[model samples]
Target chain A: MTHELLPSGIDLLDSALNGGFTKPSNFLLIGTPLSAKKEVGLILLNGGLERDEAAIYISTSNTAEEARSHWEDYGFKEQWEEEGRVKFVDCYSKMLSATVSDTPSIRRVPSILDYTKLSVAVNDWCTSYYLQNTPVRLMLDSLSAFLIYSSLQTVMRFLHIFLGQLRKQNALGFFLLEEGAHEIVTFNQLKTFSNGAIRVNEESNMMQLEGYRHGMNIPLPSAVVPKATAEASQVSCTPTK
Target chain B: MFKSNGQTTKVPTGISIVDTLLDGGMPNGDSFLIRAHPLADPLSMVIEFLHNQLKNGGVGVFLVNNKSPASVLEESAILKMGLRDFKRNGQLFFIDAYSALFGLRSNEAYFVEDPNNPVSVSKVVAQALSECSKKGKVFFVYDSLNTSIDEFGNAILAEANTWKRIAIAFNAILCFIYTEWNYPKDISEAVANLFSSIVDLITLERIVATQVVTVSKNEGTPVSKRMVPIKNAVTGGIKGYVPKILVTGPFHAGKTTLVHTLSTRAVSVQRMGTTVALDFGHVNHRGFTLDLFGTVGQPRFDPILERLGGEALGAILVVDSTKPEEFPRAKEMMHKAGVHGLPYVLAANKQDLPDALSVEEVKKKMNISDEVAIVGTVGTDKVSVVKVLDLLLDKILST
Candidate 1:
């Protein structure tokens, strides 16, 4: 059976995966402390944004303002935000008791502990963008924050539903997790639901690619994080027979 | 029959601009709403009003909702007005409502058992007025209607209505301070309509939080509607002040564009498509006169930057978003302008470009601390330009 491939915005990784990860796939990014995990997520979103594809960043760790500042740092423009091609589901500010005013591109949830509210906000964003008939990039900054706040069983349940929705909408999903933060059994359980996974070692500054049910498990070359290229970040998914 | 004096029987609010706006002073036996933002404190205005009333030989009654009577007294003493002396003379009194919120009984001259109970609060105010009114025209100050609304819910409207009736019946000047931008639109509108006159204490951002007083509405008088900048007087009350802002950045970072965008009248000394010397613009925002000076971006124009940087209350450092390499130059320009340790905002320009870096990237490359505000801007985008200015002003005021 043939599967569509979506570029991960990293040249070596894209070439190693025989073009990219299969479309409609959920990819988990496991990184050690102070690794380039966030950079990878940004590259992926910028990849979609460069192609003018709609993208949504569900931020649990940073306020929407902080996220926007990061996006602009990587050479991304605000035109995409103004045009409604980019959106942020902010679940961080209210934790600090700061009021999050509603805007077109941002939906501020009352708290990160409110899994139901976060899911609703993400679902609403997906529903609207799904109608656009273009591929979408959905990034959850880090799952560890969620795990810290919620029970393992509860977070697993939420991700099961969330990943299922991403697959249904043909959206590319990136879920970030901290290495060694959870047990091996927890990793195995999450791995079962994800189609592919990449682990980043801050000490070695290298990323290892692994497949769950597919081939292309070869370790790629040293990942040279691209230095702020506008076009290099614009990788897209193309269907193949 | 009410004796008609040559001038209206009015109580000066202590804010000279506010008094001038109200056609000399707030008319006696009338209620006025002082709308302000929650972060913007109007307590100084209230305290000044009370001091003015005391000076005029009129008794003052302050219904405290958000602050403790002790805090009020401390703040009043800062103005050199001894609240204890006024209380001893039966010229000043406080009805503490904040203590009830904390489930504590206050030892103030008067206390409300239930701040949410409008009838009980009204009864206390009525009894106090009976005792105080004999002295002269009483000044009734409800420190804030918004705080009361928060505690008592919609009952505050009815409570205000009762206070209005009492003000009329007792021939006292009633002032209701409502924090602006904190209530629901419909509720704020409904409350605003209840007042015969509205004194809007608008907080404008510069290097520091400056205020302006405007009489938006006055039933019996011709309101000036003039924006008058207000400053805290050394002794007491608030006076008038102006703010000057400096706009400086690296070459081709859009400093000229920003100055042009914010300035009502902008003059630029440009030769060969670049600012050769400097750019000057003037903006009169909400009664505050802002003199905006735009420094030339070229490194060769360091002398001009230094000259414009002096006496600037605040500064804005504009940098090109797509050019991270230029951020160092931007920082250098800021230091050369003598804006070190001074309040300033970073304007990340060219954000409309596809190659533009995010504000975070610029901050990282420039080594800017998180505390310093960095706002995105696109040339010719009015909203983006205004947002940058507002952030710069907010940072200035906050510092």
Candidate 2:
């Protein structure tokens, strides 16, 4: 019955987070424009991959090819994909393009409007990893896109079911939303469901950890960014409490 | 005047359940659109098409666009399609449209240098058809028309129209792998109308995800509208995949034991031999993977029953034969679990006990109808539990 927290791959916040995010909980990441929210997601996923855990990247805006290139640009090679340690649920491709093919590591969802199919793809990957007893960490890049495609009520209901499914498999979930894209009411509604949130400030490059026992506001390093990624000196092996 | 022969002039789809659904299969010179979800891969069905074609000595040509021609063959080989041998004997050919998009030089003989031009693609397809589709039931698989349509926009529909005419002229069975990406209604209807039949690869969301194939449209055959749950892999092309099966009854009725006995692998969330949460087990029964979910039989935990019963294909109600008084509770549990109306079989469990009532007595006590199968079983015994499962599976499949 002991709880475990996996690393978030962000070094400065680890000391305050007591290890990282809760072992199996829905996490809200507030991303200001030009913030490294997506990079944090990829790095957090990399943290799980380092532990031999399976990771699912739910890309709402980026195509599978574009997403993989982003992963490559960050430093990871195709080996992780070939090994099936990482998977992508690309919801962007088929919306505009007619003939997009899926690789073993990458799956394509029809569109955000078709949330059921999107949910199904996420469930399949979670269940696959769960059955193998492999811990899973899911990253849904930019929840704002979903809000644009759907009503606020619909997205809330989706998060309720989606985060619940991830919790069922003891999988951690990270959903990033642009800072000013949504109203305060909408943000508060989503925040109420999530175990905690990471508020990022693009102006100051600082992050305020909310809801954790020892949550604190910390100034992020210059190197913890999109271009440099986790490959730089920001890479941390800080163990969870 | 010659009377109707009664013999089918139809060609088998190489899928047993699909063939059954179509009452033998599509007639020659017919086209079937195999629409799939973005997450699902029904390419195996196409591989099975070629595999079956080889057996019947029918020639086939697969148009590749999404992926490389070599990858297509490699995937085919995984589905046990010995296409290399067929290629050696000149019975199989691949229209390498995938390589042309990337400008990669392909070693394929029937390669399309530019897939952007619909006419060039059609000409290549026509030439390949002329070469191999001379005799027997010729097969032409547009590996997927989605890619060509994506590149050429709605203009590819005209090309598809042209191919449809050519397929009929050649008297071939045309199979198109069209993954539905939520296109506009007009375009979707245009695509649907072009085919004589449409087979959709659906993602059925259950406790675990399952892929099911159903014939949505057919011009000739009487559609059964049965969802054939399909599993895809490198080894098995397309096999029967039954994802979720439920086992529920009153407390101490041995529901968990029945699940353990039935599944190849099983685990129970329990405290002191009492299931507190749930029991999960899986068994490959009759070429289909049956996921067994055993609900916590305690009435206090009845709240979890509804969640456990989510999209269960079928259920097996395990009741203690010695305790007929508890039959009402067992029946009530089904309703509480939301699996009361689903295809279910009553397992008169603990039948090995000397004081156990007969199956008929158990049925009478429960006031169950004749259609609801009642099978005598010992919960701990694998054979007994398996018999109960088989009965439930029969009820589900026969649906």
Candidate 3:
């Protein structure tokens, strides 16, 4: 039996998913900087806002105000910010602030195990942000940052831990990462770990999105994850009169 | 009240709820930023203070000095403070200075956009505060200190000194200074500590409890200290403490059934019967709430479950006392939970089934060396279920 789906505020995207993202599932969105990956994440996230579900966006790049202003253009800025359903956790700051000053213990660091620990830390941080009986939709803007800081084996373990928490909470979440960072093996492993994933790309200097056989594969505008180009078929570029 | 007494005793009209938070009310002219965790009601507290002033029919005047554009400031104000009738009282005036932040136009006030030009920023703010303070009953808020920290850089000290000077001159100038946020715990703590020492009052809103507002931190040596728990008034909605516990065991060890048996409300979102994803439920016993999360016995899924259920204080590692051969995985799960210093219990489930490993045999394989308790249980029976919970609670209470 299907339950109520939260709309991402982008009409085409909401309708594309037959409403919105299914609750209690983990999905991935992959693209480069300015890929509109964050935009798509915000759409799903803002949908939760409409439902009065608390949504948290862990930004590895964008500022909270910048993210708010971008959504303001679509008339969701106030609802997302004021009513307090949406939040941003800047992981960039968290990681940057972590003191790597401890004397480096040179014991054999199990690449997979180390990554798992980092993942646990990330999950702990996310869990603490949750307040209210508000159903939550969590978005981690860039997993590549996690990967860059830790080993690839660790990244996989991290993903496993990260995805595991979301599933346990029955929350809808997305882990964003860059396309070229990992090899095919890691990609396949992540795809298997996730219930759904979408591949976003920039082609012919315009943005385009494709399905990864896990998440909604629809190419509709509202369902589109941002890519590098602003001229993606999904977004209207005409100046307002 | 505007006697020639050199003291500027202009107290902020803190709303009843918030005034109660500040121990009667904030002193007339102290400068402090509203410290907030990722999601604290800083704006609400400010508005409530305004509401209290209006409700009491006090003659207080507020001048909102915006360093950003007027449109941006107005839009944000509208979003935060809805245009309700209570907000329409005639004591508030808004000064649009957003243009000043971007090197734009200003009338009679020189804009301060350059960090190197602290002289200009300081001069402009000082002039505005001075003019506003002359109105007898006035409260000053800088909206945010984070922006000033950005524009002032290391010169934040100069900006702070400016506040110190303002407070000394007009003791009623309660300056709200906001610092830029990056969520670097150390940085935020350092800023909080620094501000706490200098400011007469410091209150921080840390979003720790789920959907509940409990005072997280207060450091200003108030006349009294009290923590207020704020909840949704209408729905009485709350995301109260739901401890996340993990249940694991060998294949078909009644792990799923155990969760269903013990849980008051439960659901499984696993793709495969072997729990490919995860399981969730809530356990209620005599007022304590335990949220149980379970995973299948497969090795590949074990780490994922362990990592997700990190730093748990309560874990129930289930073992099928009925299956002697599948005891190893149960022991392994117990060992993992122990590594994180989590207090756990052993549930020797399916005790009624024939050829069941006795509780002793199951505990031996698990090396019941420590004082951790073990209980023989039939996942379906309520009597057996309550016993298991009692054991878990005992472990929790003891710890």
Candidate 4:
């Protein structure tokens, strides 16, 4: 079936997937240690930036500042980030006990082990971006860190709720996974939840997308959580323009 | 209004809702921990707290641990907190627990040679606090409890208790910037019990992550535990808090766009970009933080309108400028939402479309009262949408 997809900016992969990824979609990029999964993830991330889409990077392996600079090195626009269009949820910095002060462009996540906080961080970013009526693209640098820190069941539970929220919000999400990082059960379990996965070959750097246009459709876990706040000194009346 | 720890006057953080929530601001010599999620800005809160303290002729003592004092001062400059000025004027003092140990230096008067030395760090912090409080009302903040813990294990919590006592002794309010780093549960609970009030920076998933602040442990008066939406630091602080304001209209009337355009951060409980559930957003505008709730326009969703408009301070009724026929439907939805008596503004949206009508024309079609301001708006234009909110807020504030 044809779909209006956001191109991954990789011509070969774009053609293989019939243009690119569908909106309201979540796709996993699986590749071995030396494969191009990270490269592919960054390209899509950068592509989203070029298209003026709000992009969020959940970096478990690197500090938000590091992820940002690395993305910048790949020619991502600085203005988008400066303007709040690009945000990073760092599960890396504070994990290393590096005390970077709070700022808008980046947020600190306490630990990789705390998947709940990590999910909430992304949820916050996606919501913040959704205010403007633009598509949001979320890229997790690699899922290996999460798998390493947490059980597959926990990571799967996180992804199910996380990706389901993205789909509901019509966001396009790409989660990178290092092949062989976990048991085959990890990959098999993820496939059941994801719409499909794009796998890059170990030696050839070639790619092929697996089918599951509509994932297993497991019902997303439901939990009701409530609302937000902004700064407040005084509310002296200002006449309207 | 509520006194604890024998503090003098209540010191305002300048954020209106918080002051009200804290019952006219945190009292001097009172201690509270702002336990924030990594995404929340405790620094901005600290800056605003210190700024108000300085402005009111009180003194501020900053015990730096997370970052160097120089870096703290340098970074806070973005908010124009005037730390340097306050320091020069003798109203602000910095105890360098981070800089001297790292071989860097700020022009701070007090410095600890070894930050890891609990007694030495305690001595320097206490000395800075004692010196600053002697001047008058004092606001002391431990830049971070999380980093202090990393630098000196679970002992930081013990140290925090000591500082709290010292601040209380001097009648100076103490604040600690603590971030949750998956510390031990018992220690986390212990840290919570150490403070009189806790301002938690929590993220709630209303389909999207929305940063919220809740106040608890406030003794003497009832703390509603009001969950307020927060924005990225605005120069002076959070301007004001309007808990709820409704954005109602017919489906496809640009209600979502209007909400999006006006909010600093927003999320719609939607499917495929259509607000099937509801839209929520926060905007710090014209010296107020307005929480906008955009309702699902379909009649099937009308049942939820009453809840959506439950406590809304005011409302914005969005309508398609070109389609006068749907005007009644928009009003009907608001009526069903039980917001008839509320002061609201009419947003004549889609004004950018070729067939759209003018603001006056939209007003005429809806037969809306003259008291309700009518604004012509293109949802894509932030200016026009803000104007709509501004008019509604003006009416809301007046009432």
Instruction: Give the distance in Å from residue B138's predicted Cα in candidate 3 to where it truly belongs.
Output: 2.7
| Interface root-mean-square deviation, candidate 4 | 8.5
Residue B275 shift from truth in candidate 1, angstroms:
20
lDDT of each: 0.73, 0.76, 0.53, 0.73
Expressed as tens digits, the lDDT of each residue in A1-241 for candidate 2 is 2368787666666766877777788778887766877776677787788778888889988897887788765556566777787889988876555346677888776555445457667888888887788888888987998886456765775676667667767898889989888899999999888888877766655667777652476555444554444443444423223
Q: lDDT per residue, candidate 1, A136-218, as tens digits?
A: 88888888887774556656756766676577667889889988889998888888888878776555445666674233332
Between 1 and 4, whose DockQ is larger?
4
lDDT of 2 by residue, B268-375 (tens): 999998999999998988766778999988889988899989788889998989998888899898998898889999999998999999999999989999999998
Where's the lowest-lDDT run of ten residues in candidate 3 chain B? B231-240
Clashes of 3: 27
Docking quality (DockQ) of candidate 1: 0.01
- The residue pairs in collision within model 1 are A69-B360, A72-B357, A72-B358, A73-B358, A73-B361, A75-B356, A75-B357, B36-B180, B207-B396
Best by TM-score: 2
Give lDDT tens digits, candidate 3, residues B1-399. 231134333343343333334434455545555654322324434444554554454323332222232322232243443323433443444443344433445442224454335566566567656665665445555554544443344465556666656766876445453422333465465555544222212212222333222222222443233333333221212222336677767767777788888888999866656677667778866545677887767777666755656645577777878776777767776665443357677888899998888888888876776687788888887687668777876665444
Residue A203's lDDT in candidate 2: 62
Best by DockQ: 2
TM-score of the A-chain for all models: 0.85, 0.89, 0.66, 0.81
Q: What tens-digit string does per-residue lDDT give for candidate 4 at B167-199?
A: 889988888888765566886887888887777
Residue range with the least summed lDDT across 10 consecutive positions in model 4 chain A: A220-229
DockQ, ranked from best to worst: 2, 4, 3, 1
Question: Tens digit of lDDT per residue, candidate 1, span B61-129?
Answer: 888765566656665676666565787787888888667755778777789897767778778877777
